[model samples]
Every structure is written in structure tokens, then in C-alpha cells.
Target: MLDTFQVAKARHTLGLRQAGEAFKHVISESDFNEAYNEIRTWSGYAPTPLLQLPALAQSTNVEKIFYKHEGSRFGLGSFKALGGAYAAANVIREKISTRVGHDISISKITSPEYADLAAKITLVTATDGNHGRSVAWGARRLGSPCRIYIHAEVSSSRAQAMRDLGAEVIRVMGDYDASVAATRREAQAYGWTIVSDTSWTGYIDIPRQVMAGYGVMAREICETMKTPPSHVFLQGGVGGLAAAVAAYFRQAWRDASPHVVVVEPELAPCLFESAENGKATQTKIVTETLMAGLSCGEPSQLAWHILAEEASDFLTIPESLVGPAVRLMARPLAGDTAIEAGESGIAGLAGFVTSALQAKLREKIQITEASRILLIGSEGITDPEIYTNILDEN
Candidate 1:
């Protein structure tokens, strides 16, 4: 099931040098806790289960693999629910406070008294699928208007999901990056506050909130683990999730421990490109792949800042490997439970699987037979038709 991998020279030197002062600007437990407290207020909120895959370990030559299944995170079907929803809520709260020239706590913002006030504000974001659904769902829950812009690459099913949540879904031409750019243009003309997870110069606050919301997952992961894994292969989208989780590990783990490896599709390896360039670099992506969630062409600036030094490596795998990874996760081995990982959801596994096949990479990343691996299945079968079609393949 392995395919060609586009390996980049990793910036492996890592330590806790920035963990105190510089990282303070990135985020902290209090930031994550604030998001977690808000997320727990949701009706059916609970910690997602972390499943072990010993079969995968045997196959990849790793000691063990712990897959954090985010498929059922409040039934939104992705870890994005944490970021998108929390960003939408926080945006409205900030706007409400700004309008009244008074401090507005999140508790009061969630109360029934502010339902009318919440309905008046609008939150906007651009997503491939999961983030859009989460944003729209959050807006609906808070009685606010949410406008989601989807690029041509996004599935109609995903756009419909946002529509189902009462979001004004706008379809734009080109790729996800184009949709993001178009969303910015639309935001300027329409006057909606952008709650994007990706950040720019002036718009770091909402994205910071989004990234902080994602930190709750890391918080949960840390709480569940007595011993940390040797390697963590995280999906690299705009780098929001990777940086959020990496921020936690940077603070939690000791120097040179828990080597963080970011996994992205070779076609759209924004983080990999950025890491190589030593800054936030934009990718000139053309075609789309099944791993739509990580189909970003640019890294988030704030996320890049956190991950540039925190992450030990970056790996890019072929698109062909994604289907196999999904099947591998879906068909559990022995005592392992089946996990329905979507296209992008299985990217880290794909990267790890491909990387583990190569002896040099194993040596370079220090992935020995005793190394424990951790990966986040960031979504479930968000697109059932694609999932079915892929599973139907050999």
C-alpha cells in the first residue's frame, strides 16, 4: 500500500527555549481551558476516545500507535467542531462587547438573555468541509448568521451540510486557498467578521481563538496519557491543529522528547514548504486530492510561528496512500477497533505508513521498533459517498 514520498530535509533541532516567553504569545492552558469550558457547555460534549492499533504497530514496525478518533466530536464528525464553533462564539462575544463599551463574559453570551443580541451578529469563515459545518452549526446554536464560502474543490455534500445548519453557503471558483481569498474579499464588502482559523497580519485574534479551541484536544490527550508517545504524526492543514497540539507538547514534554512530525499531502505541503523556507511560505497548488481537509496552499502565520520551532519534522506522502490508510483504519486488526477515517483524516497514518517503509526515514526520525506513535484521525466519513466509493476500490 505504500507509494512514493516527497521527503523534505527536516528542521529537527528542538528544545523548550521558546516555551516560556515567546510561546506566551502563541497560547497556553488558560487559553485552551477557556475554549474547553465553552465547548463543555454544548449539550452532548464529551472527550473523544483514543484507540490503539497494535496491528498497525506490527505492520509499521512501531511499538504501538494511538489514534485519537475525532469522528464523533459532538457528532460534527471532525475535530474542527472545537475550533470553528468556539471561534464563532468568541467573535460574537467580542463584537457584542465592542458595541456596548462593556466587558461581556462567555457565560453571559451563552445565556438566553443574549439570544437576540447573538442573532444580530454574523460570523464568516472559509473551509473545505469540517470547519464550515462546525462554524455553521455554531452559528445556528447561537442564533447568529454564518456565511461559509466553499471553493470549487469542496464537495456539494459538504456545502449542503452547512446549508442544513442554516449557513449561507457561497460557492467560489478555484481551490480552497482561492475560496479563502474570496472570503476575505466578501467579508470586506459584506461587513461580516472573519472567524478564520488561518491568520494574517491584522486578523490574529479570531484565528488565535480558533487555534486555542483546538488546544482542548491536546489538553485531553495529555490528560489521558501517563507516558508520552515518541512520535506524533499530525495532519498539516493551514497548521492550526498541528501548532495548537505542538504548543501543548512544547510546554508539557521535556527537551528533544516526543518528536512532532507534521503530515500533509505532497501536492499541498504548506507547512513542509514553510519549514524549508524558514518562514510562512505559500504553496502553488493546482490539482485537488481526496485529502481535502489539508488541501491548504498557505500556512497560518501564527500557527507557523508555534510549529516552526516546536515540530521536529515534516513529511509529505502521495495522495494514493490516503485510500489505503482509510481502509487500514476501517479494518481493525485483532483487538483494535475499527475507525472510520475520512480522506484527510487518515493522512498522518498514510505519512507514517509510507515513512516507516523507508529505512532511512526511520533512522532519520528515530522511529525504531520500540517507538510509540500517536496520530489524530481528525474526522470520520464526512463525505459518505466518497468514503463508500473509495472503500469499494480494491
Candidate 2:
């Protein structure tokens, strides 16, 4: 299957793995525990599948490949289901606590008794697609109003999904960064709580909560696997998911933690650029790629702190590999079960396959026959129109 598509050597950089205070301050074990405890109580919460791809492993000439399929996560079709919703609930809980002059339990705050109090608060966020839907759904579930800001490129279907969840969907003129700016500015003016996944100066708490929520997925992976994979190729958006998973795996596995690799689209490689500069840096997204969700210009400061300490390598993949990667997951090799992955969801798989097929890159990343690989399939058929077109055209 890989023979049909040409694999290019991905541009890579070695990370400065200096695990220290910066990473520790961003997320703690207590934070992850709180998130897991709350999220597990949700109506349809269940751990997403960790699928073994023997055929893909054989095709790529690796020992094993484990892809975490997050499509069915709370039926939100992405891992964003974990972060955005949980953050929104936390925001509501804080507001209710302040109003009542007491620290309220999550169960008490989210209960029907406080529905009126929850409805009084508003949650806001910016996203290309999945995160906004998660925020909107969370708000609706918790009896709050939600306002989602999306950029011009986000599809109508995605926008409608948020609207269906009772979010006021506002489309910004520029790209994703512009949408983030809009959400921040309007949120401040309206006194709406921003449940953003990406963090900046003084805005770390909500983002920290969001990342902690993502730790639940990592915990699930850690519990199910007998031993850690040799490598984990994580999708790099603003670096929230990557950072959260990296932090959890490092803490859970300790000395035996897998070598972390952050994967991004070449057109929008904020985390990739940050690794090059040895600090969190922003990149201008001059051209958008097919992977809409990963089209981020800025690396979240909070997420970068964790990634800087944990991620051992960063890889930027070309737009060419995205369609093939998505298709490959949908129509798997002889023994592997089919996975419904979206464009951005295939970043890790694409990066891993690209690097593995290239000899120099393979040796640089230390890929061997004994190496077990972990890939995060972050989303599933996020935008049906775009997904259909990609599959149909290819």
C-alpha cells in the first residue's frame, strides 16, 4: 500500500529535553486526577480503543503499531471532546463557587439544582472545528451559553455542528490565529469565560485545565498497554494534546517513558519552529494545508513548556502525505481493522510512515524492527464534505 504513494523525508529537529520546573508548574498529577474523576462520570464516557495494526507494522517494517482511535470519544469524533468540554465545566464551576462563596463540588455545581446558575454563565472559544464543537456541546450539557469563533476556512458543516449545540458561531475574516484574537477580545469585553485549549501569558489556568482533561486519554493508554511503546508520534496543533499526553506518559512510565515525537503540517509548524528556536515561537501560516485543525500559527506557551521538557524530536510533514495517510487508515492493510480518521488525525501516522520509509530519517529517529510505535488518530471524519472529496479524488 505504501508503494503507491511516494514518501518524502520529513524535516526533523532534536529537542532539548530539559525536564524541569516549567513543565511541572503547568500540570500536576492532582490536576489530571481531578479531570479524570469528573470526565469518567459523564453520561457516555468510555475509554477509546487502542488498535493494533499488525499489517501496517509489517508494511512499514516495524515491530508493532498502536493507533489510539478517538473517533468515538463521547461521540464527538475527536479527542477535543476531552479538553474543551471539561474546561467549560470547570469555568462554570469556578463561577458558581465564587457566587456561592464556597468551593462547590463538581457534581453539585453540574446538578439540576444549579441549572439556573450554570445558565447565567457563558463560555467562549476559538477553533478550526473540533474544539469549538466540544466547547459548545459542553456548554449545552452544563446548561450554559456558548459563543464559538471560527476562521473563514472552517467548513459550513463544522460551523453548523456548533450551532446545533446552541453555540453562537461567529466566523472571523482571517485564519485561526485571527479567530483566537477575536475570541479573546470579545470574551474580555463581554466578561465571558474563555475555555481555550491554547494558553498564553496570565491565561494559563483554563488551558491547564484543558490539557489536564486530555490526560484521561493518556491514562487510558497507559493502563491498557503492558509496556510503553518505543516511540509516540503526537499530532502538534498548538501543542495541547501532545504536551498533555507527553506529560502523563512521562509521569506514568517514569524512566521507561517512550521517546516523544511531535508531528505537524509543514505549512503550519508552530511547534516545529519553536523546537528550532529553542523556545516557544510563532510562525505565520501563509498557506493553509488540508489538515485544517493543525493550522495553528502560534505554539501555546503552557503546552510548549511541557513539550520542551518531554518531546525528543519534532517532524514537519508535507501536504502530499495527508490524503494517502487518511485513505490508508480508512482502508487498512490485510490484518488491521479500518480506522475513520480525518486529515489532521493522520499527522502522526503520516509523519511516522514518511520517516520510516526514508533510511537517513529512520536511522536518525532510531526506528528498528523491535521498535513499537504509537500514533494518535486525533479525529474521525470531522468534515464529511472535505473527507469525501479527499477519498473520492484520491
Q: Which number leads on lDDT?
A: 2
TM-score, one value per model = 0.93, 0.98
Candidate 1 residue-wise lDDT, 263-307, digit = tens? 888889888887776777899888887899999999988888888
User: In candidate 2, where is summed lDDT lowest over 10 consecutive residues?
Assistant: 1-10
Question: How does candidate 2 score on lDDT?
Answer: 0.90
Clashes (N, CA, C under 3 Å) per candidate:
0, 0
Q: Which portions of model 1 show Cα errors greater than 4 Å? A: 1-22, 110-112
Give me the runs in candidate 2 sitting further than 4 Å from their true place: 4-6, 19-23
Model 2: per-residue Cα lDDT over 295-344, one tens digit each: 99999998999889999999998888888898898888888898889998
Pick by TM-score: which candidate is best? Answer: 2
